[model samples]
Structures are given as structure tokens and as C-alpha cells.
Target: MASHLLLMRHAKSSWDDSGLSDHERPLNKRGRRASGLVARTLVARGYAPDVIWSSDAARTLETAKRLIRIIPGAQTVHHNPALYHASANTMLTIMQRESEPGGRLMIMAHNPGMAELYNLITGHYHRFPTGACAVFKRIGKAPWHDPQSWRVVDMVLPRDLEAE
Candidate 1:
């Protein structure tokens, strides 16, 4: 069976509070709604990530927590500091370190890294807008799946769900 992966960019964060550190920034009103939109979309599609790796930053943490509630099968979400502002290579390394083979994984993270990771996997460079979800199905052997071996099944953007 192919391993499923969802790359989620953190929801919109507040920039109004200059006093708050980037790590402490939380989701804005729009962000909260967007998060819920993504969650509902996942539930509607009957997709629940079995394992999750999320950035320790407040916004990502909130997104992960909120997103999982709609997934009946979702359990633990591993919050790691390294994921906060990880680079493309760093994110790839984190995925490689997973002990569970063929387990569906979800990563809630920040911009450039998320976009870079997606581009690395898809060979298509594009900025990941806030609240965007990129779904990938990895086919064939464990530790063997590369960019070419992965198929992008869906991409859900926050705006795409605005009509809902």
C-alpha cells in the first residue's frame, strides 16, 4: 500500500501584535475559520492522518490541534522544535526518521520550508498559501519512495473552501 502524506501550511497568523514573538503568534479570526475549513474538507474526504509531525510554534500547533478533531482516526501529534522553521532538507530528514513504515503522515509547518518541501517532492515550485493542504500518495517500497514515486492526489486551498 502507498503511504499517504499531507503537507499543511500553518493558518493565517496575527501580525498586529508586534510585541508577540513569531513563535508566540496565534491564529487570527480568518485563520481559525480557514483551519476549520481544511478540517471539514478532510473529514468530507474520509481522510485521517494516522501520524502527525507539527511545528512547535503556536500557530502550527493550533492548526494541528484543530485539524485533528475532525479526523476520527487521528490520535497523537508530535510537536517538535525542529519543525518550527525547518528547511526543505531538514523536513525531508524528519520524514525519513519516521519509524512507522507506510503510515500516513501529516506535517503542519510554516512557509518557505513547506513550499520548498512540496517543490522538492513535486518538482513544481509554488508558494504554499496559508491554510493550504497538499496531499501526496507514496507508492512502492519504504525508504524507496522519491519525488518521482509520489503522486499528488489533492491540494486544498483556503480560498477554494470559501464558498463552503
Candidate 2:
């Protein structure tokens, strides 16, 4: 069975705030608004997944919570420490390990890795801005692996949602 992966970057975060590490920063007002829009879009598009995985960072966790609130009764949300600042390969490894039989997965993470994963799977350059989302569909396989096996279905930036 083919599985789908929805990779989302956490919404905007506070950089002006003092005394907060990159991982400790929380989402700002715009970030919260963006997340709400993303969540509504996902719900409108029927993108709810069997699992919602996110980085342990404050911002990512908060984004995941907001998403879940919009998608009530969704599968449990997990905060994986390994996802914090993880590379594309690391994220892939996590996906490969966590995927269940005929299950769908969504990942809420930061940039660089999210962009890298999108690029790796789609074989195209993608600048995933904050609150951007890339949807991938695995073809002809069950377990998620090998970037070549996934195909990009859609890439939506926060601006795209705003435009709609």
C-alpha cells in the first residue's frame, strides 16, 4: 500500500525575543495565524493523517498542537527529539522507522531539513519558507525509503494559503 507524507515547516517564530535558544523560541502572532490557516486548509483538503510527528522544539510542538486542534480526533501527536535540527536523511530514517502498514504520516519540522527532504524526493529545488508544506505520495511501496520512490503531489507556501 502506498503511503502519503505531508511535511510542514513550523510557522513564524520570534527572533526579537531575548534569552531563547533556537529550539526554545515560540511561535509569534503571525505564526499562530499561519498555522491556523494551514490547519484549515489541510482539513478542507482531507489531509488528515494517521500520525502527526513533530520536532521537540517549542515552536514545532505548538504548531502541531494547533494543527491537531483543527483536526480533532486525529492520531496522536509525537514530539521527537531527533527531529530537532535533523538533516533530510535523518528525517527519512525517522519516517522509514515510524511508518506503519498502510498508514499515513505528517511531519512538522524546521527548514533546511524540510526543504532538503522535499528536494530529495521531488528532485527539484524548493525553498520551503516558514509555514510551507510539501505533500508527497509514495508509489509502489509500503515502507518509506529511497527518495526516488516518492513523488511530489503539491507544495504550498503560507502565501498561497493567504491568496486563496
Each candidate's lDDT (Cα)?
A: 0.84, 0.82
- lDDT string, candidate 1, 1-164, tens digits: 43788889999998989999999999999999999889888778755577678999999999898888767778788999999989888887776675654457788899899999899988897779999999888776646335565678889899989976
Model 2, position 107, has a per-residue lDDT of: 84
- Give per-residue CA lDDT, model 2, range 69-88, as digits (tens): 88866777888999998889
TM-score of each: 0.92, 0.92
RMSD of each: 1.7, 1.7
Residue 40 in model 1: lDDT: 87
- Give the candidate number with the greatest lDDT: 1
lDDT of 2 at 139: 82
* Model 2 CA deviation exceeding 4 Å by range: 99-102
Residue pairs with backbone overlap in model 1: none
